[model samples]
Target: MSALIYCPFPDREAARAAANTLLDRKLIACANLLGEVESIYSWNGERGDSFEIGALFKTSAALLDDAIQCLAEMHPYDTPAIMGWRCVSVSEATAAWLGELDRGG
Candidate 1:
């Protein structure tokens, strides 16, 4: 199975650093960095808005747990946004690549 993980970073540098770390460690296949996303949400019982960099990572479902943990450890947010969604469908090549990664082959 494949999964897409979403993680938000405080800034572009932070996002780049995290992406480099994960990529170096082979925890994720690729990370797509979307710069300066406007995030509006409620926190501490109050509405807040901020500009954050968003990174979408593609990896295997089996690696989701480790990937989330890695992001949590490396992220600057007191409560970082690291969420996972199932990649129930994907292109054939992408699916095959995820499978290979999961098997570490």
Candidate 2:
């Protein structure tokens, strides 16, 4: 199985850096960095908002937990937003690649 992991970062540079790290480490095969995502939330019991970048990573399900752990360790925020869901359908080539990744190929 594979997943499309979603995570939000405070800046494009941060998102790109994270993406590169994941890709280089083979934790993720690809990362789509969507920048300029406007976000609204309450922080420290106060209403706040800002533009953020979203990172969508393509990776096997086996890497989800560890990848999120790494993100938590490296994240700058008090709590980082990292979520992932299994991919039920994908191209055969992509699926095979994900399997290979899980096998540490």
Candidate 3:
């Protein structure tokens, strides 16, 4: 199954750099860098906020865990938010395209 992964970065350059790394490693097939994200949260017993950039990654379930690990390692923030969910359905063409890279075979 295919998956869509979400991760936020400090800037577009950071997002693009990470995306390129993941693509080179075959951990993700594609990434969509969504602009300026306003985030609010509580951490270390304090309310926190951030103006970040977000990216959506496309990969397969088989590679999701690996992708998360890689993203964490390269993420600028200590506590990066990396999330993903399996795609229940996709267009035939999308499936076909994603399938080509999903298996890493």
State which candidate has the highest lDDT.
3
22-91: candidate 1 lDDT, tens digit per residue:
7777778889997779999998899999888988988888888888889889888879989998888899
Instruction: Give one clash count per candidate, in the order shown.
Output: 0, 0, 0
Q: What is the C-alpha lDDT of each candidate?
A: 0.86, 0.84, 0.90
Query: Each candidate's root-mean-square deviation in Å?
Result: 1.3, 1.3, 1.2
Could you give candidate 2's per-residue lDDT for residues 1-105 as a string of tens digits?
Answer: 888888899898888888888877788888898767888999889998888988888888898877777777877787988998888898889899888878877
Off by over 4 Å in 1: none
Between candidates 2 and 3, the one scoring higher on lDDT is 3
Residue 32 of candidate 3: its Cα lDDT? 96
C-alpha lDDT of residue 46 in model 1: 100
* TM-scores, one per candidate: 0.90, 0.90, 0.93
Q: After superposition, how far is residue 95 of candidate 3 from its true place, in Å?
A: 1.1
In model 1, how large is the Cα lDDT of residue 58? 86
Give candidate 2's TM-score. Answer: 0.90
- Give lDDT tens digits, candidate 3, residues 19-96: 999999988889999899999989989998889998999988778899999999999889898998999898888877
